[model samples]
Every structure is written in structure tokens, then in C-alpha cells.
Target: MSDTCSNVQGYVDPNWPRPDDDGSSCIIIYGYVPSFALGVLGVVLFTTALVAHSYLLSRYRTWYFSTVIVGTVMEIIGYIFRILASKKNPYSVAYFVGQYFCIVVAPVFYSAAIYTLITPMTKRIGREYAPLSPKVILWTFIICDIIATTIQMTGAGLIGRAYSDGKDPTTPNNILLAGLAFQVFSFAVFIFCLLFFLVRSRNTTDRHFKIFSTAVLVATLAVYLRTCIRLAETAEGLLEFLSTHEAIFGCLEFLPIVIAVYIFVYWHPGRWLGSESIHKKTGKSELEVSQLPR
Candidate 1:
């Protein structure tokens, strides 16, 4: 027993005792109690957002809300794993892997939801103001999101595998950095497109459109901020300051996403575009509305 324990002294395994236990020491400085508390808070908040999304879906029937719901669910699960890692065994590979993969990929779904909104919004406001057709814009950004998701997931898997195997993680870390960089670039482009649309359609007077557009802009900025943080965190590598620091993660990662989640909930697109669907109705009348112009 002593031999086995000594052999794995620098590594964490499922059979190892927690550091809080007598004669046991953690392989890494686990996340702090406050970090665990924050993870729990994230789970609760996301669950509430999920509930709100369901209610919105029932009334509005827009499939786009599903993306938000999925993203929230992933975030809740990711935080749950983060809480698990915060236990006396912070080096628990499974817990870290689960938390990292889920949390990082969760925002892609939010980006998708934002992209979905663009189609409906463009149609209602004026397609002429958009650089591309609604369908083209929707699919184009969704495809970019998919590409980013794939790269990040692949990189995460490689990093996790390398860590577990007690091998150097530099290659995988670089891959992860590349993936984060791509996501940051993609989000920047998406934000630019959104701003362009807003500027081009500034003449829109519909109250619902204004509210929906404002919500989208806020959500996009929040998500963009979070993405930039992630890019920096990844660039610093897994064991670096940003990666090890719970405070940075809580403030930059957890807070921004939660803000975006609430923004989407408060200004739910369904309220404007759902059953009794004002966006569709307004879109149909756009030709007539355009004749008057602003």
C-alpha cells in the first residue's frame, strides 16, 4: 500500500484519499472554497435561466431558444465538475477534463443562438441593410461556430489525455491556444456584422426590434469579453497564472456568461418573435414600412 501510494505521489487517481484526510496530500492546490461556491452559484443561475427559456419556448415556439437552453445546461454541468475538482483533490484528472471541456464549449451554443436571432431580425428590419441574405448569414456563422467547437474539443481532449499520461502538454496547449484564438477571431467578425446591421438599420422604429437589438448587442459584448479572457487564459497554458487562478476565472468566465444568460432571459427574442410572432408579421409588412423610410 505504501509503495503504491508513493508511486502515484505526484499524480491524482480515483483511489487516492483527499488531502483533507489524514496522511494524504493533494497533488495540486485545489480550487478554493469560494471558487466552489461560485460554481454552485453558476449552476443555480443557469438552471433558472433554463427554466425561463422553457417558459419562453412554450409561448413563443421559436427553436432558437433551444441553443440557449443547451448552453445553459452545459454550463451547469461544467460548473458541477468544477465543484468536484475543488474537492481536496484538485488534480483529479477526470474532474478537470469534464469541467474544462464543457465550460469552454458552452459559449459556442450562445453564439449560435445569437446567430439565429440575426436571421429573424434582419428579415423584420430590412434585408437590404444586411451584407448577406438572412439564410446565408445564419448558416455562415453557425458553420464558423461548429469549426471552432471542433477545434477546441479536439484540443481539450488532447490536453486531458496528455495530462493523464504524465506527458508534456505543450503541444496540446498550443492546439488549445490556436482554437481559442480562432474563436476570438470568429466572435470579432460576428460582432462586426452585428454592429454593421445595427448601423444600417438605425431607422427601425419598432419597439420590439429596438429591445431585441439592444439585448443582442449586450449579450454579444458579454460573450466577446468572456472569449477574450479565454483566449488569454489558453495562451498562458494550463498551469499558468490565469489557468490556476480561481479569481480570474470567476470574474472573467463565470460573471460574463451569467450576465449574458440573464440578458437573453430578460430580453428573450421569443417575446418579440414568438407565436403571435411580431417579427414575422413585421417582416411581412416591411415592404410597406420601407416605402415611408425614416
Candidate 2:
């Protein structure tokens, strides 16, 4: 799509002398007016998460969880841009790109934070049961995350350039799609490995390990769901149903992320695994009640 909003496929009439002259003339970059209410809600939830994470950081010094800090900050910035896009110019390319980059890539950081879990988890359960060394697993996923984040950033820059220069957005869109899709795939693999590690070690673990693992699982599912929603929206083309619908975004994307962040706070790593005095040794991290720690 072009900055003039003329070339945007499935959107823009391309005949209007002034595309953003009025809402009637063009559907706008977002396809619909972003809700100020939801934007505000995003700010509130992410801000609260940031504050909670800050406290946890200070108290526990679990620096490995720094990725969550990065994630929350991105969410806050993204939502701020969203609020601006809603209140000011929904058609402004700058605002759209700002929110796009921050919101879309924030989960990359979250995935990194989640990936760190395997190292300690493996150590707790006996690394011999894991198919690969815990450090190897951690680094592998984190590297994949870095690669995905780089791709998203690269695509974001190119898309902005494309819009500004009145060039075709197809290339950038493809890049973004590939990046997001790969991230989702990597996460699915990570989940599989996590499950495999747990199932193979079916003995039992302490309460702390269970709580810590549960937090990761819940947060992981929420983030995974959010990413899947995003991938679907992007894959369908910018002006399609998922992209145009604010309600879908609110329910699927926004709600899940908020739940993910808050869930982590409630079952925080710092609260559970922070002390590291868990009394048990081995087990899986899944639905089997017997495998769960008492």
C-alpha cells in the first residue's frame, strides 16, 4: 500500500483526490476506528504488569526474566501509539507502524523469557531425560526468537518505506508474514519439547517447580494464541476481516495478552521459583494430576 492510501489492495478507492480527507472517502489504515476504551485498557493492564514486574525484579533479581520487562514495555508503548492513532489520525502511517512494530514484536521478547524456563526446569528434573542439553535448548529457541524479531523489524522498516515511497507493499507484507509464521512455528516446537521433557521424567517435583511451570504454560498458551491470531490477520491481507474488525482484535489479541501478563504476575516465577527450596525432584508439566506436585 502507498502512503496516499491509493494502492492498498482490498482497501482504498484510489479515485479520491484526498484519501484521508474524510472517513467516508477511505476506510483508513486501520479499516475501522480503534476504540479509545480498549486502548486505555491496554495501557492500564500493561502498566500494572510493568509495575508488578519491576517489583519482582527488585526483590528476586531474577535477571533472566528481563525479557518480560522488555515485553511489557513494548506493550505499553504499542498501546500508547494505539491511543494516539485512535484519538488523532487513524490514517497516519506513522501511528499505524508504531503500534504495529511494538505490539507485533513484543511477544518475541515474551517468548525469549519463556524459553529461559527449560534450563532450570531440566536441571530440576535431571537433564539426562531431556533429548538435548538444557542450555542447548535454551540457546536454540532464543536464537530462533532473535531471528524472528530481526525479520519482523526488517519487514516493518521496509513496509514503512514502501508506504512512504508509494511503492508496492507486497514484499514487506510477505516478509512480515514469514517472520510471524516462523515465530509461531518455533513456539510450537518449544511447547512440544517442554511436554516431552516432562512426560519422560514422570516421577514428581516440588510445589515450587509445579507453580513455576504452570505459570509458564498458562502464559505460553495465551501468547501463542495471540500470535496465531496476528498471523491469521496478517496472512489474510491488511484490509481483510481480521484486520478490519476491532472486536476480534479486542477479544482474541488483547484479552489473551492481558491474561498472559497478569497470569505470570499471579503465579510469578519470582514468587514460586525465586526461593529454589522446592522439596521434590521429578515430573511432567502437564494435565496429569498425578504428575503434578502437591
Q: lDDT for model 1, please.
A: 0.76
- Candidate 2 residues lying further than 4 Å off, grouped into runs, are 1-27, 275-294
Q: Mind giving the per-residue lDDT tens digits that candidate 2 earns over 146-244?
A: 999999899987876666555677789889999999999999999989878767775677666666676788889999999899899889977779988
111-207 in candidate 1: lDDT tens per residue? 8999888877776677888888878888888888888898899999887787666567789878878888988897898888888888888886466
What C-alpha lDDT values do all the predictions have?
Answer: 0.76, 0.77
The parts of candidate 1 lying over 4 Å away from their true place are: 1-26, 29-34, 276-294
Q: Which residue pairs clash in candidate 1?
A: none
Clash tally, candidates in order:
0, 1
Clash list (residue pairs), candidate 2? 204-282
